[model samples]
Target: MKKVLFCLLALGFLGGCSTKEEPKDVTYDWAPPFEEVRWSMGEDAVFETLDLDEEDATLNVNPEKQRVFSFASAMETEVGMVAPDFIFEPGFGLVGVNLHYIPMEKEAAETLAKLEAAYGKSDDGTWSGTKFGELNLSDEQVAAFKKEADIDKDEPVVTIALNQDAQAVKYQECVFEGKNAAILEQVLAK
Candidate 1:
């Protein structure tokens, strides 16, 4: 009877002194913001954001065309050293940028496949499928990529396209917000 009582008391004590803990607070809406050289940002702001070899970077101004261009072997990407051109206009400020020139030696399709595995393929090309930063993201089962890189709704989101003929990925960026793209189109047209 004493042994039975001791066992019962021990069981009761063990039950009372439970090791189970309260559930941890889970974060749901955690997404990173991708803000850089934004729309309408001036030349100084553009330079401030870029990590360039300032000694090599050259600024060319055409008074007749009212066009300004800054370019250099500014970035040594995973592929190779690339000269990214930053295009600006007087009133339009920092208008556009031609960046991320992947060397032809690196197969663009192979490069794209790796990105697609992590981010998923978009209608246009391989995209970071966070629903354009709109939906619930998986935070990636394989990797930590839950959503697309974050940017303001009004900011320009750069996209890459596979240039099969060239065997390269093209970095096309228009540094304009909303209907400003159309405005740029009109300017280019002129």
Candidate 2:
């Protein structure tokens, strides 16, 4: 009886120890001040509200290189902070938020954790700073999807991108789209 009881206790203890806690749903309180102008064609508010100096914000609407407009800025969020280069379509709203934050170890780790939890593991079962080369998650797209799916604000769908280099341990880009899975899939294809 003593041997049986000890074995049972040990099994129970091991089971409990091995169990992994479910990742909590992610919530976002921070969004670009001019998010509403997204997807709006010919909206000057996109540049007007950026509050960035003329030189800092670069507008290169060249179709050859697929460049529209790119600007560098820091975005603060509940999880942490990210400094990304904002890319947008000339007339339409934002299309990409490219970030390179490897020097800031703590902030990068926190950002990675937040993305992993919110995304609930990548389809391929891989985890790296820049897992996907370039990711796109548009805020307008996500919001529309959530609304269509009947998912409320309480249960959010956060979107972020990761880029990994074979030889480099540091992550080059971490893009966070407000709330869109379809857009993410579309941009990740290439």
User: TM-score of every model?
Assistant: 0.40, 0.42
Tens digit of per-residue lDDT, candidate 1, span 1-190? 9999999999999999997543332222111111364534556766676644445566676664434454645464332344566556666565454444345546455545544553456455523212223422233311222121234433333333333345224442212121233222223333
Candidate 1: 10-residue stretch with minimal lDDT: 25-34
Worst lDDT 10-window in candidate 2:
127-136
The lDDT per prediction is 0.42, 0.46
Candidate maximizing lDDT: 2
TM-score, predicted candidate 2 vs. hidden true structure? 0.42
For candidate 1, the TM-score is 0.40
Model 2, 1-190: lDDT tens per residue?
9999999999999998985543323223223324443322232555565454546656675563333444556555333455545555432245445555555556555656755674456643233222121223345444434443454434333345565443556554665443233233333232
Candidate 1 regions with alpha-carbon error over 4 angstroms: 1-35, 53-55, 61-70, 74-82, 105-107, 110-164, 167-190
lDDT of 2 at 174: 62
**Candidate 2 local distance difference test against the native:** 0.46
